[model samples]
Target: MTKIHTLSCDIETHSSTDLAKSGVYRYCEAEDFEVLLFGYSVDGREAQVVDLANGEQMPRETLDALNDVRVEKWAFNAAFERICLSRFLGLSTGTYLDPASWRCTMVWSEYLGLPLSLMGVGAVLGLEKQKLSEGKDLIRYFCTPCNPTIANGG
Candidate 1:
């Protein structure tokens, strides 16, 4: 069997800018933008979630893998991961990681006439595990911008 060196990753981020309006570049430029969690699986191993929001550091090996061109990086929406990581890694403001090393499953799904949502993809592929419907609420509360108030810390 051929061995594969790949990382499948997803990141949850918080930004004061509206991602739906400003797009990733501008959204990430927000001073308050931060990666809350980074979820990844390496070579099909059990997935891990790094709680960056709580000051957790990513493993050195995983960090290296992200920088290594030889290691493929896969994600449902690879561009977002790549861009967010590029910012996190302190790359120059206008620079981003090379797109050649990344793969986007969202593009593949669209090519295959599947919906652009994880739930839709799960339903279309008849996968046993589906993305939780409740995730939307959590994302709204944490990942998107909210009214800055004393109670929630904004």
Candidate 2:
């Protein structure tokens, strides 16, 4: 089968919730923020997870697709993936993946009167692959910094 020039991406990043409320612009600027996990699909293929913290390199095809202006990128909240990837890719501030090439499922969900979260949307749509239930907890534990307690080994 011929592969389509469409890439779907999701990223887990570290940033202060306080700062992120303003916008992704400020969120990307956070001193400690970094991409920990990256989930992606290319040409509508099966999704794959890249553990960025574990030194996994993105496949060459995916990397090329990311920079290729022709590839259409998508995500539940496309802005977060696009913005975080921009930082991870070392693009300058105010400059990231072109929005024209990206699509946001969140916006589409809202348009259709569906919930904003991936899980909520999936549940409502009865998708077989629902978003993981422990995602929020995992995110809070791994993506956010604790109070720096000795017990937690911070």
Per-residue lDDT of 1-154 in model 2, one digit per residue for the tens? Answer: 3445899889888886544456777877888878988899887789999998899988877877887778898899888888888888899888897788888989999999999989999999999989898998998788876676854785
Clashes (N, CA, C under 3 Å) per candidate: 0, 0
* Candidate 1 deviant stretches above 4 angstroms: 1-4, 148-154
Candidate 1 C-alpha error for residue 142, in Å: 0.8
Highest lDDT model number = 1
Instruction: Estimate the TM-score for candidate 1.
Output: 0.92
Cα-lDDT of candidate 1:
0.91
For 1-154, candidate 1 gives per-residue lDDT tens digits of 3344999999999999999999999999999989999999999999999999999999888988889888899999899999999999888789988899999999999999999998899988999988988998999888887666954775
